[model samples]
Target: MSTSLSSDAAVTGTRVSPPSESRLRSNLVLVTLLTCQLMIVLDITVMNVALPRIQADLHFSATGLSWVMNAYTLVFGGLLLLGGRAGDLFGRRTLFIAGATLFTLASLAGGLAPSAAWLLAARVVQGIGGAMAGPSTLALLTTIFREPKARIRVLALFSGMSSAGFAIGLIVGGLLTEWLSWRSVLFINVPFGLLVVVLALRYLPRAERQSAHLDLPGAITATSGVAALVYGFISAASHGWGNATTDISLAAGAALILAFLAIESRSAQPLLPLHLFRDRNRATAYASMFLAPMAGMSMFFFLTQFLQDVLGLSALATGFAFLPTALLMFTMIRTIPRLLPRFGPKPLTMTGTASMVAGLILLTQLTDRSGYFPLLFIAMILMGFGIGLAVSPLNVIIMSNVEPHEAGAAGGALQTLQQTGASLGLAILVTIFGTTSRGAGGSVQHALVSGMTAAFAAAAGIAALTFVVAFIYRNPRPAN
Candidate 1:
């Protein structure tokens, strides 16, 4: 079956053809996008489970080991706007294939790395590939599912996969690290990436090439700014924030970020269109996306360490412990469409964020004697539900209100914020953990509580802010 494009002045003026074999082809596209999304999300958490092994194998110093995660996240977040623009200018399909290929190759390189430098370089390349591919996934979905109802359903599924993918990654990472080898975690991306590329080539509708110009200044400023900020935070994890170098790095990062905003406001073609945040809902969504992940990512980071370092669980068992959280998150996602119409996103998001806060607060009570059954289980469930509830609605709000022509940019910006949040959150939380851990004289239990309490307190504060933000969202009129 084929689709035909027609010019519509009311929409973007760029003609969009409806898929001829809508149901089958649409589902196929969804699967392909989900696969890509899952791979990217998995990369974030999978390495976490294997950090210890990677460190031991490569003889990496504590500061250097974080490069395994930071390299990927920094590159991915930095180049995202460029990638999104590439999709618009070239074609989403072309970019997706190229990105997938690059990602696959990088994964192969990372798997075989014999030294910390090799692994870190491979991770940077992987991030570049991910930056290219990730935005296209959401862009393709937007172009394919134009209707409100259909788009919401697709977005819900996509959002759920994204939220739950980290947990799934933990499980997969653990299984691979425990049963096969830590290297297998990186190697596993090979088959999945190849599969996504092949399926995308066959199933995705070809998009018209747009002649969009790259926002070079905006891109440079934003990327460098974010990198500096991330570097400063990570540096503070090891060097005290009062250290001259740490202060200099952070001050420089802050200046660059401020300059990035200034450049964006003046540029005709901004990499991150500042106008997207004009809508109160979108702005609030962006803020919530950033803060929500700050605590959320820290939870996974420290918790994984606690499980292995403090509780003495094998990697495999540690991964299994998170299964319940992943399951509950997926379940909550399925209910979003039904619930959105009845209650609207405001109540759901507020409630979910509150639940997450509760979970994080509960987690602060952990000690050497705490077991997985009651304390860990309850915390994981709350975290999952809170994140699940916020993620779906957040995506819907960001994409739902934007014009079709801007979908790619909006999606890219949304993802960029999400990743940046995760990276920043991890850095800050690591600092808190490291500082407290040091002050506690290396007592694992005391350090865990000190870091977790601070992290959870921040999370609760963010959630409370989100509750106020939810008030900005107007309830949609009930269906007659």
Candidate 2:
């Protein structure tokens, strides 16, 4: 494994500089990159709690409110491959700075926006920036930590940040909306983004642009295809599966994706390296990564609603309620480096998914009257451990063996799968919840609870499916 900063390894690992100086310099680089990654992840949910305030402040119609979020998802998910290709072609460090700068500026604009249209415009730019930067962050990380041990450790941190982000987004959104204005959620990214940009210029090493030809046809179809699929799912969430628009989007997406694949197979220079999918282990890892999020996201979506809607918790309280899971997840990162080398990905993946399944199974029994105490609390803890255990190893498998040339596309493909999987999963679960809730004979509270329980059961099944996937790993190899 080759790392980004040979200087870093020399300073910190070999003590070419004073150990303290070396560690601080290397650590700063890690912080700069991961902080950017965290900001992107947080933005996904941070606005959720502030929706009402945004609507009230901007005078958004009901339909307009949905686009604020949808605009970001469609653009971000759609442009990721193109973004990654641009990174490899133009230089990742250059793309990273440009992307981060755009995102930061967009955040500021969004915060200052006076009208619904203005905010929506800013959000769409934020998605573009996120698309540009997101793949580079992980690809750069994979490039930087050449040493296997160090790569695993840094990746654990990255994975942990991603896993905890959903909860933290709710928490941050709640606190900002409660203490300041809803604008604070968007405003918070500016300072951090500026810091990342400034530090990236000084601390990060620059790579020369690759000489590969851009696969324009592959890029266009892939981007449009992914964008359509994401829009379809987002539409399904709000409008249900039967909506003509949803059906049209899904069909168009599938057709476009097929076209993208056909183009890739024949292209001299593919936007996404078709060769990356040839290895069974790597392909399986990609599949598991997609499924893992698909299984887990329902818990976050439904549980948040249950807390605020059924449990009568305030926005702030609802945000804080996720701390048990968040804290435990962060704590687990510290131990992953040790556990991964010892037990290998197979056991860890199976155990992690099994734990999540058990936790979701417990959630399947929830009633409207269930408290945050025994049942909800325990479920969170299980999910915390499960996520912490599962994600790092899976990320490693997708990332571990890449040629330097393909790093950008590999990272993009990995994340694209995740984003696509999450959107589709949520759409499926939302549909399930709606269908089950409608059919159940109960009062409003009971109906909501019935839907939630049914959704959770579906999540458990997804987790179980993940466990089955992990079980199929033959002659398991140690991550180290």
Candidate 2 lDDT by residue in tens digits, 129-175:
99999889888888877778888778878888888898889899889
Per-residue lDDT of model 1, residues 1-480, tens digit only: 122122221122354434444445566677888898899989989988888888999999987887888788778887777787677767878998899889999999999999989999999999999989988888777677776676677777888888898899999999999998889999999999888889888777676776677777877877787777766766676676787877887888789889988998998867777898888767877777777777677677778877887788999999998898899889987888677767777788888888887888888778767888788899898989888987777777777667656677788878877887776666667676666666774566767767666666666666667666666776552121
Clashing pairs in 1: none
All candidates: TM-score: 0.91, 0.95
- Strongest candidate by lDDT: 2
Overall lDDT per candidate, in order of appearance: 0.78, 0.86
Which stretches of candidate 2 lie above 4 Å from their native place?
1-4, 7-20
Against the true structure, candidate 1 has what lDDT? Answer: 0.78
